[model samples]
Target: MGVFVASTRPKVVVTRNLGPETMPLLLERDDVEVVVWPEDTYCDRKWLLENVRGATGLLVMLSDRVDAELLEAAGPSLKVLSTMSVGYEHVPLPELAKRNIRLGYTPDVLTDAVADIAIMLALMASRNAEEVTAVVRNGEWPKRPWSPFMFCGPQLSASTVHPQRTAGFIGFGRIAQATLKRLVPFGLTTCLYAGNPATPADPAADAAHARAFGLPRVARVGLAELAAESDVVFVLAPGGPATRHVVDAAFLRRMKSTAVLVNAARGTLVDTDALVRALRERWIWGAGLDVLEGEPVIHADHPLVKEPRCTLLPHIGSASIETRQGMAKMAAENLLGGVLGHAMPAEFTGTK
Candidate 1:
């Protein structure tokens, strides 16, 4: 090599501090110029705009809104936009499409972690884990003797001769497979899934996934069938125009009287008002929600809040240490790939 040119390095801007593990990967590259935010929190809009002015790549998080303003600020040099979240609702796709910018997102990497949270939500909701723990902490449990059926909740793994258990999915995907696998031991033998049409590989791949999980059958059914047949229904779908309020009053009415609902996905997929009415009217046995519609500011008078059977969480689906680290690393890789003129390892193709 006669003379190595340092001018070939492309500029990359990270919107947040990716975990320590990912720092080495970006630093090791000579063809990439990486600029990381010193703070552990989200980067300020002004700072981001200033830093991203001449950058070729941007690695952002769900918290950061990559709207037209941010994209316009990045100018002609920008080649790629990557987010660490599976949900790209925050990004403005139309603007990116106009500029021919490639997008990257971490999807399958955090699937198992999210599914684990979904299962935990179901278990906690069904067993009244929150209230029970509160009672003990407040010294109420010690004051009173345990009575029959007092604080008792519906059994998840009930033994039966026929084993007629059924689970439903609002949006079935990789995380759904992991959740189904965990529920198999609880005598769950059937599943009903309802959502948008399968992708090119979805039909065959879904069947294989179902079989591998030991589920007796996994059928793509309508919303009504999912509501009526399932003992527990998990909402794992994406949030957007087509799926907004997919689960409404009409769908809730069809659910089995003893059924439970769990949602670890987007809040927009469910009608909070309709869900409140359903819970108030006892249409379903209970509900477990990690994500809420109009979150961080839920109405105090919300019906789900008053309903004893409802369990609410503040959306910590992918909160695990390992999963979050992986997400950060993948996001960094996406930015680095764009900066280095290579294909992203987990690029968001905007298929859906």
Candidate 2:
């Protein structure tokens, strides 16, 4: 009898369709068997758990959970999991480390996109743009009579009257740097960022930023100073237990009453109840958020939603078409690299 050989194709499961821009990379490969979730929305957990069995690699969204149960179901054959989003909180790092699975995430590709949102949120929050727009949407724009100083709020730019502005960042990362660069045109005088205190201070790097951005001062400060002095505070920090609720009532209470808060980062970084209280008590002027603690399902009656001074989005920080396509392409490349035993293009080794 003739000898029979089995196919050595690696099995890859995709949580959501990557569309034509990225799917062709995997579909054209004869060495890979690709199984996609086949839907527009989030992939159902039941379907994911069932199909993820024997997967050699998985390209997942932030909605999918890559925990011990998923890892066990994927068996020893699962060597890689690449997330389309920059955040990886959905995937447990310990579990991946235990199984020697490489983690890949899209990072720099979305930096500009997120920074744009951060600035937009700052402007919107300061101007109360959300509530103003709602008047038009609710068919009350014609009925509501305008008065002098009716919609007046803090201005983001520095004029002759307000010659200097200080911008603050919760985390000094690529996105935060991009945001600082964008603020240069607004006549920002000083830049302050808060990072892990355990990490050594880099005066040289801060000096470089000041020189590069033409700012008078670029310094690192503690959160208390950042909250107190900033005209606008951008929350661009990473999410995890270490950073959870970093912006509690104490932090919010310290902020300038006219200063605006913009959070384009993880929702858990800010304490929701504290924020609501701050807005209600007028401790801060307003807030613009692209993410919320219990997100993707915030009801209309949700306190933040009902708060006229608050402008919120459904975590669309990286929703730009160019950014999404780039992320999809990178995620596909990472999956292929891990499956083929090659070095991933953007493998996350975690902070040292």
Candidate 3:
């Protein structure tokens, strides 16, 4: 009888522990060797580089920079990169395409979770919850002077007396549309969106969306018009050079003083310094943000943190238990599929 030989199993390096629910899907696979970063926080940069050497597949978070240097560290053995995020800003797509590597990301699963948080942030910003909570937490509520209008801000919906509410979106993608759906019950009368000008206009589609959402009108408009007309403006645009600082001093200055600004999208879409000045000068009613520029490094003295009108969250738009688990499972599936030479569920087609 001829002796049988076992083929070498492909190796995969996951950047972080994927939690109890999803880690086993990778660990129990006998056809692959799985290596995971033991730390809960972003895997140490040096450690990631060392472990990625000779890795056939890589699983990363949005915090990981999958650029030329890291790609070089992974060597030619790397065939696939999977990220547990909807956004791919941290991944260098052109470099990945140059190397003929497939990319995968979590997308649709996060839409609802993020949309919910967008609405929550809008409410928080408009109600001045950040300032109110600070007062209560600092034990100043008892000594503070109470007035009828104290802690009051603009209402999200139009009252019976003033029944016209307009919601503006910087990007009318899935999450933005989901948020608009949620806002329909709040009596939103009109919807305005500013799409990427590079893409062709689809007025018919916009009209369809408006009809489906029960809004009297839904149309694409210029950024300046959107900033000026919205009762509450939601920034859901992608992050990149073209979109960076799209919402700056000039844009903020155009917004209604009673309008609220909510950013549940990329931090770079809004200029941090400009936003600080906007809040300080009361250019707009208040601002709520789930992501911020140079986040995870925000100091106690950060101007936005100090600003009473800015309600900040530590990027928890997709923090729901169900949503995170789905993201992790899909990311693992994508990594395994790519390593096994199978089709990825959510392959990044931008490079293709």
Candidate 4:
């Protein structure tokens, strides 16, 4: 009689340490073998390629590029790719689709977290938190003179007695709408959004959104109008070739001097060079940003870092403990489902 042996279990390669809350989801699974980078930071590219040679599943982060090179390195056994992010710009869709590989991502879970940050950025920029906080941090407040209008920029709030304040959004999607809902309580009277011209407008939906927020005005307008009229403008547009550097020199020049700019979206959407020039030239009041172009590689002498009028965060929009854990759990489920030939909890279905 010939002796029989069991087949080896499929492997899943994770880019980074998914933390205590999420790591167990895969570690506890007896059906698959899991390999993690074991570091809190980004996984080394060289190590990733070497380990993913025969992985049936890959759990990646936004920092890891899911391009042709990485896909090819993963070999024929690579059946699923999951990322703990809402955006899929880092993933090469065409390549994944061509290979018949399933792709999964976390989306709505981070919407509220990002929206909260957007509002925080708006206040930080408008209130000159960067400069004022620096005064105290550098111990200059003791020596500095104070005045009533010393740091005044613009008010985010508007009352019935005061002039109405308008909040403009570059892309009025889920996050944008959630942000608007928050702003409604802060006395936001008007809302304006500018979306892709290719996408047909829905007047009925817009009307319903306006009614829900009890805003007197909510209209879809062109970029020029949004930049000019907005008291505070939020750039929530997706990043790609089409929307790259949408807020360039021309758009900056059109904005009101008192208008504050808040960008929690992709960094490439706003040209960094143009923004530096705008801040230096005082084209607008100030700016707050979470994501920036060429981030994680920013030098100490980077131009934005030196600019006092700009408040910058190192891409911590969805860093809330609850949201991050939720995203990771969702991503793990997605990878497991795809590997088992089941429907993913949140599969990428291409752009609507």
Model 4 lDDT per residue over 1-352, tens place = 9989754888999998788999999999899999999788889999999999889999999989788899899998999999999998999999999998999999899999999999999999989899989999999987878889887767788856556889999999999999999999888889999998898888887888889899888999999999999989999988999999999999999999988888998999999999999999999999999989998889879998998889999999999999999999999999999998998999987764
Model 2, 260-303: lDDT tens per residue?
Answer: 99999999999999999999999999999999998887999899
Predicted structure 4, TM vs. truth: 0.96
Q: Candidates 2 and 3: which is better by TM-score?
A: 2
**Residues 89-200, candidate 1, lDDT per residue (tens digit)?**
9999889999989898998888988999888888877787766777889889878787898887766674664368888998777888788888888888787888576433
Runs in model 2 lying further than 4 Å from the true structure: 1-6
- Ranked by lDDT, top first: 3, 2, 4, 1
Cα-based RMSD of candidate 4:
2.0
Question: Candidate 4's error at 133, in angstroms?
Answer: 0.9
Please provide TM-scores, in order, for all candidate models, with all chains considered together. 0.90, 0.96, 0.95, 0.96
Clashing pairs in model 4, backbone N/Cα/C closer than 3 A: none
Which pairs clash in the backbone of model 2? none
**Which residue pairs show backbone clashes in model 3?**
none
Q: Give the least accurate 10-residue stretch of model 1, judged by summed lDDT.
A: 197-206
